[model samples]
Target chain A: MEDIIVRYISRIIVPFVQLYGLYVILHGHLSPGGGFSGGAIFAASMILYALSFNLSAGTKKLSHDVSSVLESGGALIFAGMGLLAVLLGTNFLGNRAAGFPLGIPGNLFSGGAIMVITFGVGIKVASTMITLFYSLIEGEGHSHD
Target chain B: MSAAAHLPALTVVVPLFFAYLMPLLARWRKSWCAATTLAVLAFTFFSSLYLANRVMSSGPFVYHMGGWAPPWGIEFYVDYLAVFTALTISGIGLPVIVYGIKDLPHELKEGVLGWYYTLYLLLMASMLGMALTNDLFNLFVFVEICAIASCAIISIKESRECVEAAFKYLVLSAVGSGCLLLAIALIYMVTGHLNFTFLAATLPGVMAVYPKNILAALALLMVGLGVKAALFPLHVWLPDAHSSAPSPSSAVLSGLVIKIYAVAMIKLLYKVFPATFAGMAPVMAMLLWMSTLAIIIGSMFAIVQEDIKKMLAYSSIAQIGYVFLGVGLASHNALLGGILHIFNHAMMKAMLFLAAGAFIYATGVRKLSQLKGIGVTMPVPAGAFAIGAMAMVGIPVTNGFWSKWYLALGALDAGKPLFAAVVLVSSLLNGIYYLPIIVNAFFSKPEGAVAKPGRLPAVMTGTLVVLGAGCIIFGIFPSLVLGLVSRATRLLLGL
Candidate 1:
């Protein structure tokens, strides 16, 4: 990963890939590509950065501890949304029935808790991917084979 | 809907929420992981009991997710059978976690303890989800979660054998999951419904038009669940995985985990598939014969295992066959026996595994031959093992007898005397393998590590005691659980 050209190109492209991931996650409720795909896209950027740089560099960028906390935090966000419905005396994951503002139908922040849940899933999946890559690389060692 | 209506969702969601928090808790407060797991499993247990009570008092009901009525959204159907399976899961699960609190740290690294709890809770939630979910796709999701968690627990030990065993299990389990997904797709294609009630309603009409598709789905469903359940022939993955896992993991894997698949299969076979369709395909007859082979062969293999845990793993295959035998017999008594065996075998196997764990913990002895006169030194674990062994042999006073009795009676009821003989021969095989260990432990002289066994934690000893007592108590008073078992049987048989 000492190749200057590869590292420089990845550094330039990573931001754009992440921005696209965010865009997909934000528009998830209104569009086809939701949390899972968007999250994978974002994770791909991080993986690319790691591959282009090095494992130690990747750990510095997203540290195992941070990625792990984000992993748990992301899922908590999703579950918390569902629990909010239960607390509100509706069924679990109840969207409109829980009386949260859905905002304008076609706009950002629309679709009530779904957008938030999607955002949470985005975080969960991205962090999970990064953590998996870091552990697999670190645990298995960086061998060409 | 009232707060009580939310019980089904809460039962699954609570554990999942706690599971996500476990690794963080491990980092911040390592001690909290075990206590939190115990508390979460306890909550699951009591809620399942409450659900069971409500079902018994009134009848079955459905809880829709997000207030979206199904055939459109996921639903939790809280019926006699659902509650029965849920109660079995949480009831057995709680005790296993209690045993694991003391057992896990001894086997696993200090840092990964939190991760173990996370996997444990996820496994708990998924099994409970599998029990209650009314939709086929939802069942598949839960099945996958259960499959993944079970494999992780095995591999978490990080030993060579553990890793290899887990890999074998993962491959077979993934194949099973694929078969299950394809079966669901087939069912969905013909019925245009994923909800169990809707599928059951529509399947009969579709059965006439799509005979081949329906039959293929049935075969795929059986093979998929059977592999997970370790129903002979397809059970090559079970012995290695179960034997190599840590004691508490072994207890749960052999005890509650595999049985859940059998429960799922029972639900699909009895509820989703029409009786006429089952009759047309000879599914029950096939189950009967396959179970017969599992019983005979699993025991024969068990009789030869030198490792105590491996023996117990093979024994689990045989014990599960009893449950399937009951299901296959299609007699009211036999089905009752099969369902009851699920509970009975879970307790016995868990107790046996924990006792085996205690032995290994104290003396570093796993081979049955090295365990001479272990009873003389470690009375508590040895006594529990004795109780479990007696249960496995289906002694008159143990809980195992009632299920075996019902299975045999059911065989007679179904006019299959040969299966009754199979039951008798299996019991003899059970006694042949299990009795010697007890006799040798009690009568032979203590030697080497057995002479001065290390101390067992009070909590570990306490769990074994409780499970052993449960075996005898439930054995003596079959009425305690029979009410639910009989009712579930009647409903499934459409009596």
Candidate 2:
């Protein structure tokens, strides 16, 4: 099935999918698609890239080391956000009580903890996807047999 | 920041963050993995102790995660009950790592060591998280993490049986996790809260409003956790996985992992289920009777096993039965004894596994029959095993004895002298299986008995000695542990 349609779709759809993934991530704080959903989209974008190309070629673009670091960094950032409250003379993860400006509840960038937790959930999701991809890529040709 | 809200988070995050940082750092230096694990464990131990102290002096400590503040947010209760569980996880866990350093590399294949530590730390973190979590959903999450990681660890050796056994463990445990998740969702739907304390407030109303939901959720939770905990009928996964896994993983799995799940069960019965649970008194009796069966059946099963590890694995079910029986009684002291056994068993049984591994390390022996002449050759490990054997049989001057004594006392307290007698009888049965190993080791002489050894490596030998010594120390120093346990039980029972 490696025909003209495959070439054309890969040419046009891949960039759009990738761009849409970026849009989801950036617009997470404002809309229904926050960190976890957006991060999943980001991972799916890479996976689509891999499926179009091969595993090694795709991983070359999305490195394992960088992904693991992102995973760890994401978790750390999430935890660090919580710990920041402790440093700020409030309790740990005291999002609203520590005053992150809970703007109009229905508006974008509202709900202080919602944003922080969203970001954290995003990082965790992104990292997990990356790690999974790495494992899949690294063990591409290996067989239990 | 009433101190209740953060203790659980600290217990979890200290180990979790460390576990996360560990392999990342181990990417640079391998020794640093072991060193970092110990340091993180030390930090967790101290934090748990501090939580225990607060629980003892102040009362149960409650912490809300993300400061969304429970019902809406995850909560951890660092009561004496939780602190005690956390302490057991760390206390037993630290020594396991110490033993694993030389011993595990010897037992497992290459390309798996880093993953081993990853799974180990994850195991420790999950147990810690499970023990401390007050939110049912959070507890379920930690339990799944523990189950997955533990199952992975079980098959780390790449043995054919290990693979099949781990697969069995995986499928059953995944089912159990699904049941637990379903239970959590059911509870949340009924109680409108995932936080345990909130559930405590709301459960009575929910139980009244939706009695069917109450039973369904509690039953599902029990089935899920019982499988995870390896209680009676649900315990089919334990023996194969425990025996087939590498020694260190076996030690952790048999020693403390199951009891942490039992503690979760305790939370369900006493805290969340309560009046509804008592209303289901028939179920409790069924649990008690089955635990009695577990004690009888597990000890008998242990006697027949030729593989040294298999014998110890069966012994674990029996030892766990004592905890289940005590908790099953659900009386104050009975529950205390069950809770107390968690720490006691963790120390004593893991000591047995480590000592067993030492033999496996030096002589490459796996079966009990093969070890007839082993005592003559490997005196220290054999001696350590003998001490562990005696401890397992609940001999006085070992920690096992005290927990069994408490359990017996608890049975008597519950006006069930027959069950107390059973507890006593199980000890004898424990002796029946374990004593032969000692006698055969120290006395019997098989062919080609070569007594050439200083000791297993210090990491290995030292861990066994310390744990064997701990079995004695904790036994002798009963008041220290009992005080913490009684306070912990008081917290659990809300006295």
CAPRI rating of model 2: acceptable
lDDT values for all models: 0.94, 0.80
lDDT of 2 by residue, B436-466 (tens): 8889888987544234443579778788878
- Model 1 lDDT tens row, A1-145: 7999999999999999999999998899999998889999999999999999998888898999999999999999999999999998899999999987899989988999999999999999999999999888887784645
> Which docking category, incorrect, acceptable, medium or high, applies to candidate 1?
medium
Q: Mark the regions of model 1 whose C-alpha exceeds 4 Å error after superposition.
A: A142-145
lDDT of 1: 0.94
Which residue pairs does candidate 2 place in steric collision? B4-B61, B4-B62, B4-B63, B5-B62, B5-B63
Chain A only TM-scores, each candidate in turn: 0.94, 0.78
Cand. 1: chain B TM-score: 0.99
lDDT of 2 by residue, A5-120 (tens): 66567767777776776566656778668787878887877776666766666779877777776776677666677766665546667777777788886666687765766766
